[model samples]
Target: MCNRRRRVDLIEPSVVGTRNVLNACLKAKAKRVVVVSSIGAVIVNPNWPKDQAMDEECWSDRDSCKTTKNYYCLGKTIAESEAFEYAKRGELDIVTVCPSIVIGTMLQPTINSSSLLLLTMLKENFVDSMHVYHDSFTEVDDCEKLSSEKLQDLGWKYRPLEESIVDSVMNYEERGLLLKK
Candidate 1:
């Protein structure tokens, strides 16, 4: 039988959770284990370079994240540390994947705070309004490719950001909310 588990954000408590699960899998003598992490674990850039081609090697600096940079990023670093520790124990066959900002449709009518913020920023011209990424933005296709790399590191392809925005807007429209003109 195959089993699966998921923990999205790498919070401090997740260390314990990950350990518990991995330990169980080991005790159960599971065949495979896969862990989903974030690229932020390696790439801790507050202002992630838009032009640079980021890959798996880059890691975000946890110490810097602790020093008023961003809490979410710090959590990711801590979580990643826990994951590495688990993998080091050699108790489970673990594959870790790190992805950038994940954007898309909300499964529910009300979206999460982060997703809502991203949706608002993208659809309402607020990104342009705030000048946040006036120069560049990450597309969903690219994000999906990154996600694919995180899990499999292959067979994932890139798509333009505009296409992602269009898809997201259309998704929201299905819920009777017009995101953009």
Candidate 2:
């Protein structure tokens, strides 16, 4: 089950959940317990430029988290640390997937509500209408291009932002959605 919230103090619950799952896995003698995590777990605001790439050794700084910046990274760091601790304790086999800004087809209509909103906003130049942000954005197709092959070598694949947007738009159109313009 996915848990989403802004509470910085709620890391305890995640730790507890991991413990329970690890315990169950150990009791069951499971071979693996793959954990879905985020790249944010590592790579929190180091000296690296935005264009720089990060790898498994990277780790986000929870101490730098604030209401304005790094909160998500902080939570991810704490949760991932807990998972690592569990793994070190030899509770069960653990693997993790760390993707940035997951976007793509939703298995259920309820998921990825943000991608849908982004598509709706883009369909009519809503950003331009609001005069609230940058001028001229990357096309959806362009945004999803990433080092998928590189990540795949590590047993990971990211849904490019472009692919997610296009898929969302097509899905919406198939569902009878129409562009206002």
Candidate 3:
């Protein structure tokens, strides 16, 4: 589940959504379920354990995430864990696709908080000018580009990334949100 609220307090919604909402999906006799998770579920301290690599076998350390104030990562970790727990108890056909930092044009009238922050920083002179921590592996990529690769593996196709950006720009323009010249 995506973090849609301004508040960082997510334990309640995370519990309700995963337990009740997931059960609802099963009751509706849904054949398959797909949860869009983040790499946050699998990664922590991006530079730690220099030789370590994460796959489906690995899970993020919730304590580490919490202590470090990686609230977003903590949220993803909990939600995905709940999904797996639910799947384990039932014959639920579920798939969790964890992706790295997702970036793309949004269809919504207003972009998400994270996206808005990035857009503001890139296009306007606001916020911190420098980040204290530098991690080479952490870089943003077009959301459509990344998702398309996974979709292709599953025999699905979507529009090109360029088209996605174009659409985003169009949406912004329509909503009177213009990029910096």
Candidate 4:
């Protein structure tokens, strides 16, 4: 899912892999399953009311995503949709958590896509060319703010945003991936 190089590459892992995981969960008789979706799946729709805050109810238009060539969003939407459909069969309880751009200290030696994005922004002249395919893929101008209200209601706690950024930067510096500035 992290690889945005090819649209074709996204289909197998996101859609098929998600279904396989759900099937395995059903077979295992798991009581509850949580699928980590992305905000990309929720807020990518242009049809959402401008003044209304997007919530779990909102779904990105799949056709719109395809027309715009936003494969990442398309993949996430399809995967999440399939997950809900599987859950609707009433075999197992399924919950989908859609998080916005996550930034935190790295647990592994290598950097991940989110951290890499933060790194690119932190460092000057990181890439030769940056092509933004569409505004919806990168930004959500209509919504007032991205909310964690749903997660908060579930008693999920997160570290402060400042702490996350600082920790990530420190981790990058310690790993010699980023020079101390």
Candidate 5:
């Protein structure tokens, strides 16, 4: 029988991961750690202010994640939250970066979920599901615009989205991640 991903699977492991990693970091007397979270932890908030742009301060509402059945978002929300809560003890300086649908070069041999979604769109023009996106950021065709202000503030620079797309396609082809027709 084929197994399926479940909310419990996502949420429980994230909670455990945070516990184990933090414990190890504390035990080793690590001075700092940078957690790479996703924009799912921000935009999944159903109660997001309509006119306000999403920023680092925004967090996905837990109830909203649960209601929308966005298990990844739920997991990220809990994991990042638990990590930050533990970091608040001042024992370690834990910084975090919450990136949005990253449409750029893949560093690893395997394409990431964000790149996979884009490739799927090109091939099938379909997606399994999407989170409760703020209406203002919704686009039926083109990729929606998201504010990367916080990341920018941290000196994170990015190539143009169009350039990134072209580069990703080329990279995918080189890596043979794209299905041959």
Candidate 6:
């Protein structure tokens, strides 16, 4: 069974939900708001220079995303754009963080999409061998490397990728999601 969330399923939560949060922040007179967008929004554009690394400045083209049926990227782009627009109209300090694929021990009992992706990679023959490029998955084969310079400049630090992967694998094993290999 395909675990992909349909475009319709994502629209309300990604677009409308963001609007709701922004409205609530406005109502509460929040001094600052941090919006957690995805790297999907920044990396999908075909017009960006191939030699340049993708940064916060890059945005996925909404029309291109629509034509490609990449609803997730489209949603994030729209939501982030809306947040910035709202911020421009008001005194709200909106900061958007677009993170790449995150892999680590999950806080919740149920596995999330990113974790599931790692899990699928670990399990041999768990999925069909045929390479399928669906709308839910981004084709990163030709994409430029993503840069976190802006975030690092802000004094943010992250655990090594190997450490994160190990933590996630251990968590999965402890939860009986994966057999000891």
Best-fitting candidate, measured by TM-score? 6
Root-mean-square deviation of each candidate, in angstroms? Answer: 9.4, 7.1, 8.0, 7.0, 7.0, 6.9
Tens-place lDDT per residue, model 3, 57-170, is: 667788888777777677778888898887888857778888663445664655775456545543454222232132222344422222235456878765564454445445
Give Cα-based local distance difference scores for all models.
0.59, 0.60, 0.62, 0.77, 0.72, 0.79
- Residue range with the least summed lDDT across 10 consecutive positions in model 1: 1-10
- From the highest TM-score down, the ranking of the candidates is 6, 4, 5, 3, 2, 1
Instruction: Name the regions of candidate 2 deviating beyond 4 angstroms.
Output: 1-24, 47-52, 66-69, 112-117, 120-150, 154-164, 172-181
Question: Number of backbone collisions per candidate, in order?
Answer: 7, 5, 1, 0, 0, 0
State every prediction's TM-score relative to the real structure: 0.59, 0.60, 0.65, 0.78, 0.74, 0.79
Cα lDDT tens digits for candidate 1, 88-143: 88766676666554566667567755467666665555344223354235336443
Worst lDDT 10-window in candidate 2: 127-136
lDDT order, best first, reads: 6, 4, 5, 3, 2, 1
Compare the candidates by lDDT and give the number of the best one.
Answer: 6
Model 6 segments more than 4 A misplaced: 1-5, 125-142, 179-181
| lDDT by residue (tens digit), candidate 5, 52-152 | 77776788899887777888888888888888888787767887777767776788777678888777764454221222122222345433335777667
* lDDT measured at residue 160 in model 5 versus the true structure, 0 to 100: 70
Q: Name the candidate, 2 or 3, with the larger TM-score value.
A: 3
Off by over 4 Å in 5: 1-5, 124-147
Q: Scored by Cα lDDT, where does model 4 land?
A: 0.77
Pairwise TM-score winner, candidates 1 and 2: 2
Question: How many Å off is the CA of 133 in candidate 2?
Answer: 20
